[model samples]
Target chain A: MSAPLLSVKDLRVVFSVGGTLSRLRGHVTAIEGVAGVSFDIAKGETFALVGESGSGKTTLARTLNGLQKVASGSIHFDGKDATSMGRAEMKELRRRAPMMFQDPVGSLSPRLDVRALLAEPFRIHGMSDRDLDAEVRRLLTLVGLPVDFASRYPHQLSGGQARRVGVARAVALDPQLIIADEPTAGLDVSVQGEVLNLLNDLRDRLGLSMLIITHNLHVVRQIADRTAVMYLGRFVEMGETEAIFRSPAHPYTAALLSANPEPDPDRVHDRIKLPPEVPSVMARPSGCEFHTRCPFAQDLCRRNAPPLRVNGGHQLTCHFPMNTPAQAGLEQAQ
Target chain B: MSSIRGSRGAEMTMTTDQNTPAPALDIDALSVSFATDGGTLHALKDVSFSVPKGRITGIVGESGCGKSTLINAILGLLADNGEVTGGAIRLGESADITKLTPRQMRDLRGLQISTVFQDPMGALNPVLSVGKQMRDIQYRSNLSKREKDARSVEMLRQVRIPDPEKRLTQYPHEFSGGMKQRVAIAMALMMRPQLLIADEPTTALDATLEVATIELLKELQQEIGCAVLFISHHLGVIAELCDDMIVMYAGEVVEQGSVRQIFRNPSHPYTRALLDCDPARLHERVKHLPTIPGTLPDLRNRPKGCVFQARCALAKPECGQPVTSVEVTPGHIARCIRTNEVTA
Candidate 1:
């Protein structure tokens, strides 16, 4: 088999947080944003990092696109050591790996019209203005936005239009891989569908690898080929999308799948409710971060962190991994 | 909490009559408009829906579809420039809410009806502790400090906020997003109001947290026996938690029916389109999602006939005429001229 396009090993990102007052109190806390995480993404594949807020999914995406600093561990991107890349190499890497932001309203330049926003990438890459206009129009059409909308400012566009502009900007440089952070986050379902379709189309046509970071399971089901479920800066389950949805080996993954609300009223779901709140990342648990909320957490789970183990093409980090009752029932029926 | 409601017994009786089976809320051709500088924006156009006693009624629409305007009109909380041009909001058999003065409405607010907004921080005070805010809501009540504190703690526990006593002493900032929503839910239910208006209460939380919050809302609604008017843009949420649903488009209700009937046999083209667009409903992979072709018609330039005709796929030339709502099934109504031909 061909090597993966991106490989990350034992990645860690730590930050020191404190002010002068905290210094007087002798308390400077370190926040481990991404703690010893590892993953690989093959070319022309859609890999999703699914997690809620404070789960460090965003941090991991930022690291992938060179926007975030890596405190430790190694990253091999397109056969290059990303962590040790110098200034020129970093710039080149950035050109090949573009990022789509979560908030299109904030990401798109308010002062500039859509034409300029989309054309700026080409200008930055030293393309002449003659080619820029054509490229801008092409990108806009690619994302299904009208050519006339190219003259509209960011504020003038609707939520769905602004998101299309975000996608248009991300793909302007014709990058190999796109990192979209909650691309359809605040959009309505119809609009979200449009964006997802655009993403799926672009991935297939351009033969681009994508790293989609979101908390939405529906999006994961619709677009992702493989997925990694993250919780508090660590991957709890990683495998094929269908397999994870069918039989989530980790308790957190099962709980998350159950929590997803289906649109069909006939298919009434009984969700597995987690205990009150996800604990603060600053004071993470001593062993497995999820042990405090895991329904099947045992003493061994609370005392020692479980290592990721491979089983049936699934990588799960749970001491006693088992399929949920729903999955088990389906298996029994089969 | 009981004492607080007891103190406002007169106001409660005034709003809710002793009629045996009166719906919690009823609106008859309610119309709301805002006097903008350009022209009068018809925020809500002859909207009508009822919240049955002890049942959950959901209103689903896009952001500018006037779902919020309908909720605002119910609470008499529209903006200064906005006005109710026509129609009546009947609260049970006793009160026509449109006729109530601001003072009377204020008196009836927490006693008879309360709201839980999407952003809990906007509803809560950052400087005040959770307990302080709860006490502030009951300032008009005759309860003592100790009783108020105990009641607040009890309400917190009722929402399943772990360490309820410790949580009350903390400020809103100390609570997580999910926890803040729980606190907000707890505060809304503290008054034991007959009607609970939850406007996108779980939109800000994650999917997992959203499920938990909705479960809590359902549990609390059943326990309090309050008629809940849940307004959300998420169809999945409406399907899961709502008993009945109202589909809105351009300030008008395009469809209203039992949740089961609407999902299983939708008659409106818009509702059918919405159901088709849902990612969860798709099992096969398609390159492009089937999109409803056109954008929502501007409220100011709303079409003369069917508001949804501009974007509807099955629209005909006769759609330009006034569309009449037809009862496709028992208790299932759709505001479309071709309801006979269309099927889910």
Candidate 2:
């Protein structure tokens, strides 16, 4: 088998707050109970990480990007261990690790013009200053922005325009991988569509591999080749987008699908009303993590942890795979 | 909550007031323009729609489409810079909402029509107890203090809030996002306004909570028999709760018709793109999810041709006509000049 472009195993990150609290007794458990979590991203393929707020999706993303320090885990990139790599080595990786943030305006420097912003990445990687201007113009044209806008500052551009500039900046170093975090959160629907199209074009034209972390399912449906569904801190299901949406295997996966409002109004959206909120990580339930909220909670669920099993190239972490909506309903009723 | 009747559980009772002759809210070709630092920006253009007595009419558009501006104009509460250049919005029969004096508008606002904003957390005061705020709004009502208390609790019950009597004393932070919206609705109904203008009230909530809130609103409308002007960006939400829908873009009504008519036969390119935008829009998988191409044009230098022509793939030379709109059906209409070219 061909080697994967990126791979991670048993990744875990924890932050300990310090102050007037006791020296020995740790304060504030931000994230815990994360078991062996693993995934891979192939060349020119898009992998998606989906979960609601505070489900550890952001933490995992940061860890993968080498922004956040990890406690115990192994991250292999291009067949090398990146966990303990030096700053210079990581900087070499960072040159290729272009990231697009959620807020485009906030991400770009307010005082810098678009051309300077786009050229910074190229200059940082020791590329020639003479070629920078030509490269900036090419990147701007590729992103579908007019050359005149290069002279304008970030504040002068519209929200959509600013996002395009941010994309150009990320791809400035000619990176093989792009990690986008909620790329379209606050933008208008039309603008969001435009930005999505730009990203799609970039992926196809550049042959870029992408790892998109988002809470919006619509985004996943549009760009993802495969999806990983996260609950608390672990992936409950990982499969092709069509399989995940059409026949979600895990009970938690099925419940989440049931809970999301169907975009079509003619069809009454089925909702599995989970109690008010998900529990905190400090008090995560034992055995099967989702058994507490599972409608089919039994003695076995509370006594044993479920292992992720493979079925027709899909991985599901549920004792009983609930595929169809009717089957999920029956499990709940039982 | 005591001010309005919500016909939530009365499914058959909703039709009772729709057949009535009197118009509850009348907005005629209303246009609101803003004087920004840039230039004279026409936010709303010759927009016209009316809500029948006890019927729900939904207005849907994304940001900058002036959905909220239209609702605020009905209350005669435009920002310091905004002005209505043309048209009239009359509420409760003869009261021309645009020309009402400050004092008269005050009397007309809560008593005749109330607005439910999307952000319940921001709309509610965190410092004040819910009960005190309730009493403050209803102090001028005919009901006495004790009677108001009874009515307030009764209104809470009507909306299906658990432990209404206890909850009234707690602050807004004590409730969840959905519950906070219900409280906001209860406050809007305190005057029993003839028209309840809900501006993306459910957008702030999750799917389960959002669906329930709409169900609650529908039941409340049935009981009160009051018209509701529901505004949202989600067509799905509008279709579930509204009898009629008005599609807006830039500053004009691109399409208007019964929800069923508009959903099944969207006559405008903008409307079709909107329906196809949702990834989960259909039970069956789409070969490719359709998306509107370009961002909406700047309101300052508005497009001379069809406002949506810049992004529309079906643009023909005839779509360049700027001064005409076509009626596509018995009660449905679109502003696009290519009415015959595009099929619903």
Candidate 3:
């Protein structure tokens, strides 16, 4: 529909996992941050990147805005190839797709007030003479903050308030795609709702495409139209949010959903107790990266990595996919 | 389990009824204050609740709601400027925790009451191996060095730490966040404390790890027969693991009841709002979540009447008067003047 806002093909990112000394000695180990990932964000749709820590969600997010160098892949933004884009084209790509961080306090300058913070984005884009002060107040108002907040410094605001300011700054330039990484984390339940709703409202009002990277499934259920579950730098499951939650195609997705403690006490969950914590990225398992932790891992799963297979609207990489009556019961139980 | 429970409360084994056991911890009109540079800040005021023997009692509140302060006060680990102005913390029949000397409190800490903090990395020493840290906690006991090492391994096994022997030798940095938390839990339970206070223990964990950790905590508590005081802001976690729940706001108890009672029929406006605010509660995705309208009142300002009145949508003129808890059900209580009007 009207060309996807952003498209990626075999996106792979790597990092040297040691200090300068090791790099000089030519013995530095290479760690895959985002390994052979591919996805598309349709225009005006909210896409979610769901994963636990070290799942490459943040790495992929950084690559979207050209902040992280791509080891190999194509990032086509607004029908433009970002990977091969020249200096001017890359600048335009960044101007159209901004990134929002999880920690508002760390992202924001302590000395700057809300007005300056919001106006900085405009100034960076060379829109210095566009009544920047008035625009700052409008951004603050758009995110449901008091107009008077423009006068207050970041430190003076509460955690929720500061995060709202972060959202305001991200949307200051009216970017088509906003990459919000763990936006509602560390906020109170009510404040989380407030922030989520604010993002939803901004999307609807501005017709903005959102790429939210978060571990919180509840947020994905609420705001995201499509979801991609990442594990050890690769997508394990990707599909519509409703389909993924209703009947997860992959074992990791099933385990993750079942593990989410629903607020309802009466709704009994069939918790799939994962054997051990997610394996460190330094020593990612052979074959399927998630085979070590997958409950349905078999000899085939351990020997050869499953290709990303698409069925109906869902796409997953799993050898022994859980699509039987037993799997349906897990979904129904929730 | 029965043997430990019986031995701990031999003299005070009086049960309220055949169904209910004596509370492991009872607080009566407890008040705690911090001497700030500006003024004396009342962190907790007239707060009263009980952790029934062998049950999980959750203290649910947002930041600055005095949940951490209450836990610190109970553990005798409050900040230097903080003081318990008035109240009685009766642990057992004759043990008044508030009156205990510093040395007595230190002796009672790991032996009687232990705590699991929020950040596992901060709670553990990064330099020392897990075995060394765990064994250090058991050193004061009469057990020999060999016995202490065995006990550390056993506790690690109980928490389901994979390859317990190998894990014990690894430093904190080597363990994943979830594994570190498990080790922290194992260390907290190494002494077999009668009361375990966990302050947002799973807040830093992933959702999957968090559920597993909570399940482990529940299983261990049942096996050890210790009263647990779980402090958290996540309603989902509290709803799942807690037997009884306490809702606090701005240093005051706004609601207290059984988990079923609270979830099924929250009588307080604040609790109802909190539940409504949950993304899980919304069957269909909506544009804006129903917010509580305003932030919690500043601790320094200290609202005169109901602490939640400032942000509460159901606040009435009568809320300006002093508010005390009124029973909404058999054991459920809500500290709102208009408790009868509010519905879950």
lDDT of 1 at A206: 95
lDDT of 3: 0.85
Clashing pairs in 1: none
lDDT of 2 by residue, B43-106 (tens): 9987876787888988977767888788778888889899999887877677567887889888
| lDDT over C-alpha atoms for residue A227 of model 2 | 92
- RMSD (Cα, Å) for all candidates, in order, is 5.3, 5.9, 4.1
lDDT per residue for candidate 1 within B1-344, as digits (tens), equals 00001111222223223444777888877889998877889888877667788999999888678988998888989999999998788876756898999998988788788999999889889999999999989988899998999999999999988888888789999988888999999988899988999999998888889998998899999999998999998888999999999898888888887888889988999988988888777664566777667798877667888999888878889999987777676567788988877783
Please name the candidate that would achieve the greatest DockQ relative to the true structure.
Answer: 3
lDDT of model 2 at position A159 = 82
- Count of clashes, each model: 0, 16, 0
TM-score of model 1 (CA atoms): 0.92
Report i-RMS for every model. Answer: 2.1, 4.4, 1.6
Worst 10 residues of 1 chain B by lDDT: B1-10
Supply DockQ values for each candidate.
0.62, 0.27, 0.68
